[model samples]
Target: MDLSSKSGGGRTGYNPVLIILGTVVVLVGGYLISLLSPSLFPLAASAEAGPIDQLFRVMLFLGGVVFVLVEGLIILSIVRFRARKGEAGDGANFNGNVTLEVIWTAIPAVVVVFITLYSYQVWVDIQAPKDDELVIETEGLRFVWSFSYTDPLNRLAEADTQNFTDSVLHTYVGRPVRLKMETRDVNHAFWVPTMRIKQDLLAGRQTEVAFTPTEAGRYRIVCTELCGGGHGAMYSYIQVYATEQEWMERFIDVRVERILNPPTDPLTVGFNLLNENAYPCSGCHVLESVNWAGVTGPTLNGIGDTAARRASANGLGGAEEYIAQAIRHPNAYIVPGYNSGVMPQFGAEQDEPDAVDGAYYVYMSDDSLTAIVTYLCLQTATGESACGDEAAIRAAVEAQ
Candidate 1:
């Protein structure tokens, strides 16, 4: 057969059947690829997640179409237009078709414009303020997250402090939440994968992020930044209640009641303080009593007994002195296996500035430190305090 005739008069003409077949293949392949998107991501737990996930699917579909089209053309050309066994001389050459070039160029430009507009609209919609939003203050430290909230109704006017902090973020379905976030020590990121919202917590500055929960469930809150040694453990949760009534009954009312009638016992107060994450201790210590499972610092399971032994071995005044010095001046006596400068200095003197000459510090009131020491002093096998009475503990801390 003549090569010219075989090449359709030296110009390959478009075949309607091949065009239709290719279109079908691209459409089917793209749809199939889009369907896998749901499995590729976490559950859409917030209203914003829906739109973001949809946008992802759209982009995936377009990408699949382009991938299939390009790969298909390459394969077809290799197999169908390969040099024949008896062929000789160079194959026919011709200039590209202007119409085909324009179509290809125009298609991508239109796709780019469409994607830009669509993504912008999605972002604006998700960011729009919603009515009756529950504002929560968020703080990120080296290895912990603390969320604070105030009573919206002012029901606990008699309480000395109305604001409370927790290790978890709580909200209800259909209720918007806005977080004013800050970092106490280093730069960190607040990310909720299920909600598809992430914001950075920069040092010396505050940032904000907003989202509305659509599902009533628990979702993990992770710090996506590499903050420090305990960065992997710097995670919490957002608990979405089914309704406002449920949230009030389960979380809000309980916290308010506790605040209004604060516990009198120092042991109980200290336990609550640590349990509620008021001091960020749980992220660095392990104490089965309070369910702290951190692995960064020394274990507190039998801290009472250990304190007694450590004080005697280190020639401290008593177990109380050992515990007090451990907190106020963590570098005073470092544990044998643990390195110094790991724990923040919990300075008790209020007159001291939080930071001086670029040296960072964290403050703890004498009352709180006393209570915490009182609690830790009782974590013995016998359930008895290894340290002295409240007066002795206060004196031990004051001596430092």
Candidate 2:
């Protein structure tokens, strides 16, 4: 068949004007789509969020334009070169154009270079630590987050149990805050959607991320990394104060009192610790006294009596030993109906490497563990002698 004679116009039928017009249409349509995509982002509350959103919008526009151009060309070729009626032969035959290939390849290379430089700049700006930046040390465990605000003069205060000074992350509006984060067990990401900052918490090393909150509101702190069974509940709140005075009055002053006049009573100490959400117990147990309504684990309404009796039957020391064993080795004795691996190992390190889903890393001291047990042992149904006596319980706690 004579393909050139059939077309009559020969290769001139390929219109460069039409190709240019189509390219323009795809580019314009893609840009418009990108501009509209910023609506998908949540409210921006941090200073860094503005630039981050800007970069995102730009990338989205570029991506949309490319998508439209590629798909448009594919559809155009399909329709323009479709098989004609009664025509059963090759439409056209031409060798690949090296010039066109080179042009397309060079275009993406240039675009990639621009994107790399722009993204690197944004990264540098967001991570640059500013003067007077408040430092918050963050530790991510199985299903809980611990924040420690260290005193500048006494940097070693975190190791001092008597101080009990380290607490939640609290800041004032416009305050530059840097978080030195690490994971106690597995990998976890610290994310604040409104602030538009996210970083991973890695084990054995410290990672840092910084942001300046611009709004005065309570923001949700989420663990984007899937650590384990309680991953869904691994969240906390960041309270941004309106002013420095307000922040000092609310957070600083309270933390000061907690450190200087630390609670001495064992029961009060245990209650305060539990109520502080330091541990992930409330999410798995139901305790009316503490207003915990979680049903993930056995009810703690009368666990003291049950635990003490179980300890005796198991030939363990007493309630304290039973509770301690449970925290360190949750799967040692599973509840009748509940599963064995439901709870995390609160005070133990991960034995196997990279086995994060079922294991965790927690830095729990004997004193702290005993205090938590002391608190749990008092969860009596009728407020009777479920843990025997104060002297006996103390003896059990101090024995080992």
Candidate 3:
């Protein structure tokens, strides 16, 4: 019953060195497996990044094969050269095998060369962008992304952001679309899971990310980086249309007209005209108490209260100066760096229609402008300050 006896196979055959080597190899192999997450995958950094995937995979496979070969040798040597009980004092010392040495060296060298060549080819394919392609301009700010589709007449595939998704940005299949990306504030990344393009946007410098969306449907565009307080809501959509014309007729042209002349009736525009064609604004900004993280526009809740964006006193005259300037030229005096285009010019101040009291901001004639300004000044006014904010009119009107 004594296992230490030679007949019972005492711990006589195992070589501690081989066991150590085998354990090391297995541990290395396991570490290799853990490096397979999306984060760990060799990202196609440039346009050439995609094709190198196969070569990258091959490199991984060769690494695994090498691990197996080395570990297998250690296991075999442990068992084959084990010490025998009463048969021999020790195993014979051995030198390296020239054949084994040459095989290990040569096989890997050949594999590495092939992988390099293959990867290079893939690199070439992706680095070169197509000649004629559309460009989407993206500007990233603290916690939001603004998409500018300059193509004007066309809209990208259209889809429902929350529940239903159907028509989306109509980008062509074969054509590569270059994204000119930058940031107004901190760093952000433009990511589209379907197209597999993720590019960083840095302030003061522009970055270019390109991809040919092979898909033909609506896809999501999300900010992959934690941008700001509301980073979780920083996302958008892209509609991938089969053809160019369909995108224009359906989404682009119609929206442009709307922005130029918003509908008069008490109807909320489909998507906020602010980002109707590009990023949806339902996440931020409030619309009739609906929460959308779109601080891109002034809140409608008390818009009438601040009659004049720039007012020394909340009198009637001061409020009038603010309202008129805000309507005619938004960029003249933006609210700090928050947003310049929050209020845009539909036409010249002369061209704006007269003001009217309704849900939408309507400008009738001179009479209405006076009426709206008066109405707004009264909305959140103290009984003492009315008749016109004389100080506001003096400074603003005189400056003009």
lDDT of each: 0.83, 0.75, 0.52
Best-to-worst order by TM-score is 1, 2, 3
Q: Quote each prediction's TM-score.
A: 0.82, 0.77, 0.47
lDDT of 3 by residue, 269-327 (tens): 42233334222344444444333344555553454455444455434245557665554
Off by over 4 Å in 3: 1-56, 63-124, 152-170, 270-280, 283-400
For residues 1-400, write the lDDT of model 2, one tens digit per residue. 1112234644344456666777788889878887888888888889999899989988888898899988886887787678989999887788898988999999999989999999999999999979999888787776767787654445335544323323245788988999999886779999999999999998789999999999998787888988767777677677789998898776666655566676777677778667765566666688887777667688888888889888989998887777777776777777788776557666434254423345454545555666677788888767664564556655665554
Point out the worst 10-residue segment of candidate 1 by lDDT. Answer: 1-10
Superposing every Cα of model 2 onto the true structure, what RMSD results? Answer: 5.2
**Local error of candidate 2 at residue 291 (angstroms):** 6.3
Better of 1 and 2 by TM-score: 1
For candidate 1, the per-residue lDDT at 222 reads 89
Clashes of 3: 37
lDDT at position 310, candidate 2: 88
Clashing pairs in 2: none
Best by TM-score: 1
